[model samples]
Target: MIKHIVMWKLLDAAQAPRFKAELDSCKGLVPGMREFEVGIRTEGMEANHDVVLNSTFDDAAALEAYVVHPHHKKVSAYLGTLRESRAVLDYST
Candidate 1:
């Protein structure tokens, strides 16, 4: 399986909830998705990013399919407008 993680710094901190909701909408978008979770920064932490996503896919191809799905593309494009920075990590487990 492949574990895919992403962190995002939003242009507006107040929009974190919206971003998390959008990320949640991506759950089950592809066949091999095993897990999907989104997290928002909590108070009292020195947070560099506003949102985080931790997900697992059966393989690299499944991850690719999720990336190219129309629903994902739409959310990604919208997020591009709302984010200041983004980071991603993927590894096989």
Candidate 2:
């Protein structure tokens, strides 16, 4: 399985619900994506991102395909604007 993780620094809670809906929408996009999880930090953690995603795919190719998938790209593009900072890690097991 391929593990893809991403963390994001959000602007505020006001905008989170909208994107949270969209983030949930992501799960239905790529069938190759075996698992999808989105989280919003609740403890006001300063050194961490507000939003995070952890997903698994069948393999690296499936992960790459997800990266290039049109819907995924659209989500990524939207994320690029709202997030102050972002981090990602992709690995396989």
Q: What TM-score goes with each of the models?
A: 0.97, 0.85
Candidate 2 C-alpha lDDT tens digits along 1-93: 989998878766556666666777778566678999998777656646778888999888888887888887898888677777878998877
Among all candidates shown, the one with the greatest lDDT = 1
Pairing residues by index, what is the TM-score of model 1? 0.97
Task: Name the TM-score of candidate 2.
Answer: 0.85
Clashing residue pairs in candidate 1 are: none
Q: How many clashes (backbone atoms < 3 Å, residues ≥3 apart in a chain or on different chains) does model 1 have?
A: 0
The models' CA-based lDDT, in order, is 0.96, 0.79
Q: Please, what are the lDDT tens digits per residue for candidate 1 over residues 1-93?
A: 999999999999999999999889999999999999999999899888899999999999999999999999999999999999999999999
lDDT of 2 at 36: 91
In model 2, the clashing pairs are none
Weakest ten-residue segment in model 2 by summed lDDT = 41-50
